[model samples]
Target: MRILVAPDKFAGTLSAVEAADAIAEGWSRTDPEADVVTVPMADGGPGFIEVLHASLGGELLAVTVRGPLGDPVPAAVLKVGETAYIESAQACGLVFLPTEADGRTPRPGVAAQASTYGVGELIAAAIDAGARRVVIGLGGSGTNDAGAGMLAALGASSEPVKAMTSGPEGLAHVASVDVEPARERLAGVELVAASDVDNPLLGLRGATNVFGEQKGFVGDDAKLAADAALTTFAEAAGRKVADAKGAGAAGGLGYGILLVGGRREPGFATVAAAVGLPDLVATSDVVVTGEGKLDWQSMNGKVPVGVAGLAGSALRPCIAMAGAVQVGNRELRANGIEAAYSLVDIVGTEESFAHPARSLAAVAERVAKTWSRR
Candidate 1:
């Protein structure tokens, strides 16, 4: 049997490549003769660098940039031919947010003061490197400033609301914005926001209200203030961008791009096409894909669901494995996933996080056994 192992990063434990290798290793134990193809994946989030680097064979260029909390962080840009791929997480990601001294776990309160300025610096680096087109991955951001910090770095003359703040409250004071200089800098380049989210900029289901808390916006009052601030920023930008689809992506980084004449494209589909995922699925007998968590969000154009959809289109059975699987069979079926498994169940909850690779391999072994019986 031929099995394709492709999974996104398992949050703090496993990277997509590590997860694939472990699954392949376990599957091999179950069926020594099985042919397993390993393809690491990402949903335009943290794993984007490795995924694009592996598939596109791009030049990985590193740059020192400000982190979400205004500290120094190492970030990179992938240039393939004339196009550059920038992973937002490298700069604005929560992964780079202030953490415990161990740097293994997140530290709260930093999210409230996070910024995307470093993301702009990376973009500038890409432009300086002669990229005529730039594709930015929008996911796992730590800030909720509606990309105000990013705008500031991109040459907007107005003072940035605040690079460090206790939530997005500072945006409430945004009186004006000027992106004319930014437009000049990005004169010839085509910019695109590759994102999975479609939430609007502000409202009950908008960026702040829906995703603010995850990034540490805290109270209802905070969200409301952030929303109002975004409104002010939008009006200054001279467009009613708050209601634009995908505007809420990466805490409105998508909208920020729109402000500068960039466009929004579906994240996974764009990356899949770039990596020839459909072709890979056609050659594989069975496809396996997953992520850190398999919840309702997984169905919302995330990597696993996108991979499953590709497999289904090619008439292939796709199995999904995750750190945790909160979605039910019906939902999985609706999204073209044939089977779903979780490492937490196989290795117990604690072991799942303590040693993800071990638990993952064990789960894959059991899954192989189950599939063999059929």
Candidate 2:
């Protein structure tokens, strides 16, 4: 049987490639003769660069850029012809921050102070190197600045550019934006924002309300930050940023890109087309795809759901193996997932994740055995 192994990153543990390898290793033990194909997946987030690099032949360029809290960090971009692939997570991802720092832990904050300036710097660098097209992967950002930082780096000033770029409050202090510098530098470049979520810039269902808690906002802080940034962005751009779908993504980096001539596209569709997932599914007997967590949100434009949709079209059975499964079996079945299994359910959350490799191997072995019996 031809079994395709595809999985997203296990968030805080294994990358999509590593997870697929672990699954393949375990499956080999259960069915040595089985044909297994591995395809790592990403939803425009942490693993975006690696995925794009693998899908499109490109050279990885590493550079030093500003981090989420203004610290110097190593970042990379994929150079593919006149188009470059930029993953925002590398510069301002939550993983860049230490879980425990000093006496008080640092939290991902909402506001314009936490800008996407470093991301802009990366894009600027690409532009300087003669890139005519730029595809920015918007996922796993830790800030909520309305892309003020990005505009600042591109020489678009909405107030005096602050020396210390740190949090939302810091961004709120800006007064005006000037894009003449970047406009001259990137006059003819095409910018595309590849986004996974579909949230807008402002409102109860916007960026702060839907994703702020995940970034550490509590009580009214998220709402206040979102409102302040939205107001500033509207004043500067002369266009209402509120209610724009997918504008709340990547800590408002989505809106930031739009202000600077970037268009938004569904991340799953982009990646799938690049990776030739539909073509692969046509010949595969079984397709396996999963992520760190599976919930109601998984059905709403996530990678797995996209994979399932494609698999259904090709008349192939699709199964999911996740780090944690929060949705019921009925829901998964309704979504075209023939079976859904969680590593935590079988071995307990704490124990399973204690050694991610071993846990993934165990789950894959069980899946292989079950499939062999059928």
Candidate 3:
């Protein structure tokens, strides 16, 4: 029997690579003779580069860039041939935001001020490395500035550059934007905005309204202010692409990319094509894909659902293993997941959270007892 294990990062606990390894180890315990193939997955989020590096064998060029708070942060660019892959999370992810005294809650007020200047620095590094094509993975962001800082760092000028380099709050004060220089900077390069969501840049389904709270916009007043600021920036910048699919991704970084001639693509699809996942699913007898959580959001172009689509197309049985399962079996089946298993169910929530790899492995072992045909 042959099994394919592919999973995205388990958020705070396990990376995509670690989750894949744990699943493979546990499945082997129950079916030692079974052939297991592991593939780590990402949806343009925190583990984007790591997963791609594993499958593409690229050169990782390390660089230091500004973080969301204007401090230096470590990041890397993956160069494979003439193309460069960059994870936006490395520069402005929520993980990098300063937290409160509790060490978990993101510090307040920063949400409205978090900047994506570092993302632009990473792009500069990629261009400097001779990359003719750049693919930017946009998700898990901490900023709500609509990529104003990114445009500034790339030579787009605004009245009082400081206002533009700052976050949404600052953009509200800016009067005009000149993006021609930024466009000229990428004259010969092809830019691709790889995003997990297809939201537009404004309105209820947009950036500030839908994603600002997680970044620390606490109340309706704060959200409204941020939205207004983003609207002001959008007016100054180009509003032509504000409604484009993925324009709201990574706090409107997708809009910024479009302003500079970048095209949008589904992050999972981009990774899948690069890793040749369709062929892998076609040859496998069973496909197992998962993530940290299985919920309504999982149905929306996340890694697990993306993998299920591939498995469905290939006529393979696909199951999901998540740390916590919130969706019922009926909904899971509707999404192409034949069956679903959760680590929190097999082991207690405490044990699962405290030792994710071990807990997940235990769940996989139990699943193998029932699913393994050998």
Candidate 4:
């Protein structure tokens, strides 16, 4: 039996590669004779480059950049020939969100202060590496300033734009918008913002409204303030980009990229094509894919669902395994997941998290026993 084992990061527990390795270990336990292919997956988040680098060879160029909270963090730029891939999360990821690290208990008032400036640094590094094109994986962000911080890192002059408090609260105060400096630096370069969501940059489906709470901008007052400020920023830039598809990505980083002439592309499709997932699925008897959590969002171009879609089209069964399962079996089936399992269900939530590798392997072994020999 040929089983394709692919899983995204288990949030803070394991990386895509680590999860794949654990799943493979479990399958080996139940069906040692079964042939399993481990392909780590990503949807333009933290593990974007590492996942692709695993399947398609690439040189990872490491560089130091500002973290979400302005701390220096080590980041990477994946170089594949003349094209450079930058995962935005590497610079501005929520994983870098200020918390106890900010020297506070319970993490107070750290959300709105986060920035995307570090992401811009990575972009600069890519250009400096002689990359003719840059692919930015935009997700897992820590700011709601609509890419204002990124622009700042790319040499957007703060000299003209006063009222620089940072984050959404001060976005409207940005007086001058300049892309010439960035453009000169990016001469002969193409910027691509790779994202999975289609939400615009404003309104209920927009960045602040939809994703602000996670980053700590909560309640009605904060939302309105951020929205108005972003609106002001759009006017300042002489472009109304709030309603554009993918404009809400990465706390409006997509909109910012668009303002600077960067185009948005589907992250899943881009990574899929790069890894030749379709061809691999054609030869597999069973496809197994998963992420940390399985919910309504999984239906919207998440890695597991994307993999399942490809496997389904090839008439192969796709199974999903996750740490937690929030949706019903019918919903799972509708999304091309023939069966679904969760670590929280098999073991308790505590153990499921504490021992993800062991938990994942246990689940994979059970699946292998039931489905592999079929």
What are the Cα lDDT values of the candidates? Answer: 0.82, 0.77, 0.92, 0.83
lDDT string for model 1 (1-374, tens) is 77888788888889888998999998889888888888888878788878888878989998999887778899999999999999998888876665668764456445656778888898899999999999999898887777777777888755454422223555566566677888888999999999989998878888888887767566777677777777777777755676889899988888888888888999888788888888989898889998889999889888899999989999999999999999999999999998899888877899998888999999999898876433
lDDT of 2 by residue, 198-309 (tens): 7887767777777776666656865676567666655665455545777878877788777766788998887888788899888888899888888888988888888898
Residue runs of model 2 more than 4 Å from their true location after superposition:
97-112, 163-167
After superposition, candidate 4 runs with Cα above 4 Å error: 100-108, 158-165
Assess candidate 4 and give its TM-score to the true structure. Answer: 0.93
TM-score of each: 0.92, 0.91, 0.98, 0.93
For model 4, state the Cα shift of residue 80 in Å: 1.3
Which of 3 and 4 is ahead in TM-score?
3
Tens-digit per-residue lDDT, 13-115, candidate 4: 8899999999999998888888889889888988999998898888899999988777899999999999999999888887776556553222434666677
Tens digit of lDDT per residue, candidate 3, span 1-374?
A: 99999999998899999999999999999999999999899989899999999989989999999999888999999999999999999999998888889777778778788899999999999999999999999999999888888888899999866887889889989898999999999999999999878999998999988988888888899889988898998998989999999999999999999999999999999999989999999999999999999999999899999999999999999999999899999988898999999888889899999999999999999999988996
Model 1 ranges off by over 4 Å: 98-112, 159-170, 372-374
lDDT of 2: 0.77
Candidate 2, residue 355: lDDT = 90
